[model samples]
Target: MYSWHTQDYLNLAANIQKRNFGALLLHGAANSGRSELTNELIQFALCQSPQDLHACGQCSSCILWREDNHPDIVLLAADNSEERKTLQIKVEQVREVIDFASKSRHLSACKIIHLPDAEQLNISSANALLKVLEEPAPDCIFILQANNINKLLATIKSRCFKYQLTYPAWDDALKLVVENNPDNAEFWLRYFNGEPLFTPPFENHELTQLKATLLKPGIDAIFALSKDLDPKRVGMASLLDFMLKWLSDLFLVKHGNNANYFVSDTSAMQGLAAKINNDKLFALQEDLVFLSRWSEHPLNHKLQFENILFKYQQIYV
Candidate 1:
């Protein structure tokens, strides 16, 4: 368990021991350890001999969890397929969950249905799941996890007992990051918006090059960066995310506020923000936001990236 979430986990465990909750919705920012906390709670609930609100490793239920074949736990997640072209939790998957919930627990006291990304539930699936939530089956607990609860249906959100796992204190989070990456701890911590538990990408050479190009953007540098970054290799979504954060910082700096994500590049951002045309920058930001939605599409990524870079360059003119 993450040190920051220790208190929340204990409180939730105490609640679980007191009375059964039909549904629990754990919503929080990405990398806030919501999934880990949910898994720990499930293990604790299923353990025949829980030790101080934690699962006893020697118990049969704990052994099953370790083996990755917990009979009473069902995981529902988005369908990730190349052909599907979208991440969605289909109605068929929810139907399976309904069926699972109706059945008896094979090994544990109660059956658990874990939906790691509840926001991925499409309209049809959400409706199907709603029926089960409306009339929850006995000895069944539904654990739903989402990064954004706004994407969920109001009816669905209303049914579950919501628990929000907020970002940890800056010092506490920084300490965790420093332990694993002492050299670039502060840099990475700021990069992820202070999310401490994220695993840093193995190679950030391309990102470093991109940052350099952005810092001193010109026609030649922009064109070079567009060609140098291969969407397949570096991930177009990642590139867009980096650019979005940088642009956000630039906007903040333009409005007489400090940089939020790229604190290390505040001086550079302030310099650029002073020279940028506000209207052009605003248009570019909107265009990038629209393009981000299609970053994963099978379109020509190189051309798209080049176009975005060209637009970005225009903001300075």
Candidate 2:
């Protein structure tokens, strides 16, 4: 489905056939279709039809893939699902992968291991895996996916075939949105980090109300929530994520990059945007890593966020 837009990546994959590249790195922001592209490659490697642009979905291998039982294709992420969980890719997961690598494929011609979010691996775990990447088995292919390539080690980076996945143009992403879920603009825009191929549920009346409340004075919203003392930790965390995404959009618009803004008019956020620069905007984005990790605990949420807002105010001035 997403293959039509990934011509360049497919061409690169074809080139690899002529001259085999042991490892390929797929790096991109969230929802930029990096995983989809990896899936395409896996399909091509195991596909019964050997066409440049198309994978025959009718083949036995393709049928197996659709059922999530492709023997040669291994996806070793922290979780099998796409949702980001608050845990590292433990040594046990790597051990399973190692075990899989030890054996040959059940049916396919080549063995392929796709590790999405490889950066989630801890130090010892990553190092142990590095040896496999360094001297991979002759018939094996390793594709590493990372959202923040900078988080990976230089040595690890050097050992792979790499490409950065660029965001599609605004018009292109908008077209994707219309084709899928045309009604839920806000949630999709925020969830995929401005990638339009994403479909996040926005029909939830609670999210709509939460968004409206956030648009009020920032400190006022905080104080009002404090009064209610709602213990819906999940909802509160989602609110924080939504607000941060809005702020990120504002920062982009302030720098004359409104082309990327999913919010129709970012003019109302001018005051907030003018208070920060590119460097500060990047720092604020990094701060979100902490927010995402600590927001589940109510005490940590209040205490940490108070300090975060305080520092943000200081930085704004």
Candidate 3:
């Protein structure tokens, strides 16, 4: 378990030991270690011999789980296929969960249904799952995970024992990052919004080039960068996320606040913020926000990206 999430793990473990919950919802920001905590809890719950509210690796249950052959655990997730472009958990999957929950455990005392992305459940699937939650089968535990509980149906959230794994303290997160990556630790920490576990070295060449262009923004550079943006390769959503963070930091610098995401580019941000028209910058930010909703759509990605870059360039005028 991550040091930052140790307390949350213990608290949830205590609850798990106290009594069996029909449904447990672990919600938090993306990459806040919710999945990790859920896995540990599943192991502990399924383990025939748990030591100190933790799974003992020597047990047959632990061995099966470690080998990814735990018959008692069912994972429900979005269909990630080339044909199925949408990121929704279909009702068919939920129906399977309902069927699985109705049966007895194959290897353990209880059965666990793990939905790692509960927020991806569409209306149909959510309603289907809600029925199962309402009348959960005996000895069946549903472990739901969501990045944003707000996106979930109110009824689903209400039925579960909710636990939030908040972003760790800045110092604790920074310490973990520094341990793994001594250099640029602070930059990565801010890049991932203080979630150190996901702050690996930023080695994506496309993003690297894009950042370099932003540091020295020019009409020619912006156009060149837009030309190289392949939606399938780097992803339009990823591009929008990077731009959102960059714009957020720029807005902060404009208002005399420190850079938030781009800590390493503070000097460049300050220089750009000083020259750009505040109103135009704010308008560009709004435009980005609007575009993010359609980033994953099969639109004219290159043209849209070029238009955004042109808008950013015009902010200097």
Candidate 4:
């Protein structure tokens, strides 16, 4: 389990045991404890002796879980690694879950399948998963996690017990960040908006450079970014997200408010914001919104980045 969990998880876990729900969907923003809480539920389900709705840490099932040797549980998520970044849940992987479910449990009384980012399942794979959920195994449970559930198919959403998680308060989030990573804790915390589970899309130095260069956006600078713009190496979505946040902060700075995304670059933000008229900024925002609509699709990533660079260059023109 994570360092923080609300009583909501506890109540839900209790209800899981009480009702024996076949499927549960945990939806939340990035860096919330959705994955950790899901693991806790897995352990609680598999534990031969659960105490107070939590897994008995010393139990054999808990030991297997700690060792990451729980055969009965499978995690299906986009690896987002350098070699193989993907949002699509391949049909073959979904088949594995179905195959795994058809068999008997190995060590525990429970079997679980966890799908992180259920919205990433493409049409075929989603249909494949839907079939499994429609006729799940007697001893199995399915846990679906998504940061944005609206992208999920209605059929998939309808099959599960959905719960949306909330972020911790600033004091609690800061405490967690500092306790876990003291050095550069404040910087990273603010960068991720205090999501402990968040993995930075780029290194600190790279992000800083990106911010500086975008503020002085020129053709050469835009092309310099485009040269290394493969989504696998550095995500287009993350870049767009950064741009959106930066624009938001710029808008705030224009109105005599402090910058949020560029938390350290108040003067730079003010200067940049001053250069652009509201009409130009609004036009950029419209383009970004259009790009975001197709950002997750395979075809539009490069096109979106191109549009963003063009728009960024125009902002200062």
Candidate 5:
């Protein structure tokens, strides 16, 4: 209700108003608007006087939300402010939600417990949350958000209403991205699959240049960007994903098939395909797949990523 995607908002609002569903799961690609929807739904559920599925900003509940002090709404999300070995929605966090559910609503009819990173809930924590879900708290609603629904446990997913919200078509999303950020339209469009907020910031010029370097890789493409490639500052996961796209495109073009990513870079892909063999391509793919799983926290991310680049260079040779 507060953002651009509203069709789901309307339907969800009505569902919330009609009766308590106890649990709901919003699944989609990374950077999809699942978090936004959960935020709106929190307000909608806690609002004393909602209008057509929107919160009344003037109500006490709405006022509390505006002040960032909603008692009935519990949001336990992954902590990303500081570097960690691995991030997760810890068991203690889910326990807090259970405790919150145990108490009466502070300002509304029911409690709204929202977990924005549902997939990050590991076994112990998920089981902790499941205990409450099985008991069925009185008038309590649980909201879960996941980037990939398949990663979630089937039993947990079955307890909640599942909604998949993937990104809109490129043309549709690019318009919004361009409207909000016009200066780096091309870079943003290509980088985020058209998801505006997911685009690397315009100020990250080094990464922008890295994109071009990957397209027309040279003998020292990795060394060229070594100074700016800080695993801490830049998202290594996304970098790996982008690299996979380029490699997959090159592989496809080599096999006389359509490219999966960077589809517009036909000539560049052709050049890359001509230089590399199928075996090398598959090797690169395996390396990327393995690195991506552990890229979140490598002992020496610099050396790890640099090695991938070196491997690519050797493949071309």
Candidate 6:
């Protein structure tokens, strides 16, 4: 846990001191520890041995939270991933939370609803929550966590206090990787797009080979590059994320701000960055970002990627 990143959350906690009807919306990119922080706050609220607002680990509430059985904490995720595929927090879930908020704490001092990935709440669900958020109960506090706040509606957004959780600097994230695997730090750092800390382990050789293909010149090389990764492997999505970031770094450098660019860290990447133009880079990034969101659908990912790559070839050729 990066204790430093929790400062914003701590401040939110402090601001809500004895204020029963407030909301905190925490937004962050993936792997930013939003859920973990919510859990910690839940513990603090329930902890019997709070040493001045901080949870004491040896306390009864801490023991309950540690055992994964906190009655006062209600959590709703997009999907069970273990079973159900409720793509968003449904209106029913919001209604339940509202009802629970109206009642009172059965055991814990405060009732907390930790809504992870809250942006996935559909239109009806957001409306349902808005009703309660506009007039929350005296003993209730809502904390909504999301990766992209733009996906949320303005009405819902206006009702709650907002906080954005930013990722640590690349150097700091890289340091953690170096601490565990001294030799593979740089390797994994590049593979994970400088986010080596939270990325899952996989075969580096595969992505390296794919990067080689993409870096080659000509339309055939571009097509080959897209096909080589197969887009079917479990690691393909991660590979595309890495590739997009690499291209983004180049895109930044091409626009004349190479001073702090990631690609500028290495001479070879910097050379590659020099060959690309900002216009192509911008269009490619937009296309990639669009495809990434749509990729979740039951579409032919290879065909989708090929179409995008073909545009690159048409322009770069």
Best by lDDT: 1
Q: Which residue ranges in model 1 land beyond 4 Å of their true spot?
A: 201-204
Better of 5 and 6 by lDDT: 5
**Candidate 3, residues 172-231: lDDT per residue as tens digits?**
878877887777678777778777777443355665778888777787888778877665
Between candidates 2 and 3, the TM-score winner = 3
Clashes of each: 0, 0, 0, 0, 0, 0
> Which tens-of-lDDT digit does each residue in 1-317 have in candidate 4?
55456576787779767755899998875586777787778788888888888789898889989999888899876556634334577889899889999999988877989887787798999999999899888788998888888988999999998888767777777787777676567766786877765666776667656776687787777676666555546876787778888888888998899987577787877777777778888888887777666665666566567667787767764
Which residue pairs clash within candidate 1?
none
Give stretches of model 6 more than 4 Å off. Answer: 80-86, 166-171, 180-197, 200-202, 217-228, 250-286, 306-311
At residue 192, candidate 1 shows an lDDT of: 86
- TM-score: model 5 vs. ground truth: 0.88
In model 4, the number of clashes is 0
| lDDT to native, each model | 0.83, 0.67, 0.82, 0.78, 0.75, 0.67
- Per-candidate TM-score against the hidden true structure: 0.94, 0.73, 0.89, 0.78, 0.88, 0.79
RMSD of each: 1.8, 5.0, 2.5, 4.2, 2.7, 3.8
Candidate 2 residue runs with Cα over 4 Å from true position: 79-85, 183-193, 199-237, 245-290, 296-317
Give the per-residue lDDT of model 5 (tens digit) for 66-139: 89898888787878785875677888888777888888867798888888788878888888888898876868
Give candidate 5's error at residue 181 in angstroms.
3.3
Give per-residue CA lDDT, model 1, range 56-122, as digits (tens). Answer: 8888999999898998999999867645656898889898889889888887877889988998898
The order of the candidates by TM-score, greatest first, is 1, 3, 5, 6, 4, 2
Error of 4 at 89 (Å): 1.9
Report the Cα lDDT for candidate 5. Answer: 0.75
